[model samples]
Target: MENKLKFSQKHPLLFGFALILTAMVLIIGAMAVFNFFFFKAHRNSFFGTKVGVVHINGLIADSLRITNWIDELAKDNAIKGVIVRINSPGGVVGPSQEIYAALQALARKKKVVASMGSVAASGGYYIACAAHKIVANPGTLTASIGVKAKLTNMQGLMQKLGIAEQTVTSGKLKNAGTIFRPLTPEEKKYFQSLVNDMHDQFVQDVARGRHMDIEKVRALADGRAMTGRQAKEAGLVDELGGFNKSLDVLRLLTGIKGEISLVQGPPEKSSLLEKFLGKLTFKEQILGPRWVFTYE
Candidate 1:
């Protein structure tokens, strides 16, 4: 028999090109399947009357997600009102304030009600003030209005371990909160002033949101966590009840006679890499980073 080359051997270049194209298609299909399973968005009907629920769970590290949800609810016509369910101890000052501001803006367009859960203190209560009404469980802990900065001095540990860190700065206050050594008196005073200013901002915002006198808010803004009943007495909470109570309040406010459907935001989606490294926080990555002003 005469020797004959196979089709793939005769067309090596075309075979290679076909393999590459097949890989590309497979990759795209896999990506589509992954997105469908993990990153699909929540779908809400545009015609039905719905009430949006924004849950502020755990620490408020970043405001991007919550603020984006608020913006979406604001533009959605199907969402007649919103119930902000809070269950957090507190978090970073800047992010907390951003969430509060976003809620305030949303409250202007739609009826916003805050429903406090087991523990909604500090920054949690700060955001709740932006709502038109606040409902809390009788045993719920709320209102820890204060600013705090936590720093650690690692000088002794470094000295024992013979590890030294050399830092160059332009000014005396430039590297204020270095963990290499204890804070100087001047640094302490400066940090205290910053904390006071942030606390004042918190007090002023709470007063404005609750429609109470600044002094009254100042009196209660002593970093004291109070029960829902106590907060109601102090004019910080509007009502004492749980989620169902909040639903009735929203129903009454929006005049929704029939079944009130609760709409929540889509599940949080993170990249595959983020899922693996989400818990690792490198605090020393920043220069002279020791103090973190928070509402805890």
Candidate 2:
């Protein structure tokens, strides 16, 4: 008891400092936990005025998540406008079209602008058409308005390995894209017709969105990519500028003169273990089933 008393008397200030430090660490940890659970609901309330920013990065795949997010933002009255930041080379046909449709629906209700980064080609540009305005860097790769279908034949490799496979199907076209055999001339024609139809659909959407003649869009929709500056000249893009410039455009369109709050969609949730495994198997997941029509 005497020794304890002597130590406390000699180090009272140090003891108080340690106690305060420990309390601060605990407080910070508690706040982190609270924010993780309740931040979405509280964020808008914390910020007086804000524009919701939705990022459509990497390959444009499934649209359910993105569509749901846009719907949620549409219902939120606090979000004055929306900015869709796209950085992609494009992906599957169905998902890209779905995303474009969703964005078009959102545009009817609120002002939505598209900002391109790096490579936003093919279906990336397709979705951008749904926005009220599109902003891109001068050198940004913006337009590759077309579709592509690729099927790899593994018959040669299988024969080299002395392996053979057989399949049974109800219809001949059911196995149209099978890797074991090459496509017949008739099958090739069928696939070409399908691609041409999708191309026409893309052209119609672009013409409608940009208020351009269908013939003008059709002439340029020959699976050719161009710089953002070229796209602007062709009436495919609204402005040639970077992300910050896109925010400025949004500010002007919304008429918000003061400070603007930016709200972004929630980050994708994945476990550390899942992320590690995903890295190992990303290619297979991204390019599932070799025969797919893409806007890449």
Candidate 3:
């Protein structure tokens, strides 16, 4: 009986130590996870103001996903302003301009700044021009002031490849750029007119946003690319600087500097452990990111 009693007493003590060790491990794990979170949040803010970072990193689309972020930022009083980091060539004509308009409307209420990454030209520039201020890094490539439509007539190839195409149309322009045959003169004229109209709207929007003359903007809208410095000279960008520099400008404009939150693209929804312990790695994720970005 005495031996059994001693064992029982020792068992509880051992159990207590084991429990304490387990708790320590858990606490350490949680601290590691959340420590980085605080660091990142604090690091992102400037002058005690939260600066939201929105990333436009792919082909712009018609989905509200992008516009919704902007709207959210506009409503959040915690976010003094935004810094849109753009890295894209361009995408569908309509979606690109739609996003630009949304940002312009947001700017009326709060400071909105743009930060051009490796490539913020074409439709990317379309959106950038809408911001209250624009910033580009030393090597940023921007300014593709143009619209392009590619129509493929695969009639010959389809026939050669044993594929066929047929069409019925209510209007003459309904089957305008049909791939089965070459574009007729009327069809060409119709497409050119559509493109020209869209181009005019683009030019006007850029001119109004950049505070530049319509004539000068029209002159530069010839479908060409320019470096960050060159774009500044042509009035395509407001300042030649990087991301933090852009934030400084936003701070100056908004007159608030503390913790800056961002209205950015959705994060890639995978955890670090999920990648490391699992089969995929960061490289695979990056390689696949473009597919997600393009929705293709």
Identify the leading candidate in terms of TM-score.
2
Across residues 36-121, which tens digit of lDDT does each residue of candidate 3 receive? 56666544423355666778876665435678787888788877788889998876676787788888888888888899999998
lDDT of each: 0.86, 0.85, 0.77
Q: Would you list the rank order by lDDT, best first? A: 1, 2, 3
Per-residue lDDT of model 1, residues 1-296, tens digit only: 12234656888888789889999999989977776566544222222469999999988777777899999999999889999999999888988999999999999999999999999999999999999999999889999999999888898999999999888999999888887888999999999999999999999999999999999999888999999999999999999999989988988888887656578863465687764443333232211346788898
Model 2, span 1-296: residue lDDT tens: 99867877899998788789999999989887787577855644345478888888888766666888888888898888999999999988888999899888889888999999998999999999999999999999988999998888899998899888687989887778777778899889888998999988999999998899999999999989999999999999999899889988988888867656678874574689866664555455456775788888
TM-score of each: 0.80, 0.81, 0.76
**Segments in model 2 whose C-alpha atoms lie over 4 Å from true places:** 1-48, 273-286
lDDT of 2 at 107: 92
Cα lDDT for residue 188, candidate 3? 81
Error of 2 at 57 (Å): 1.1
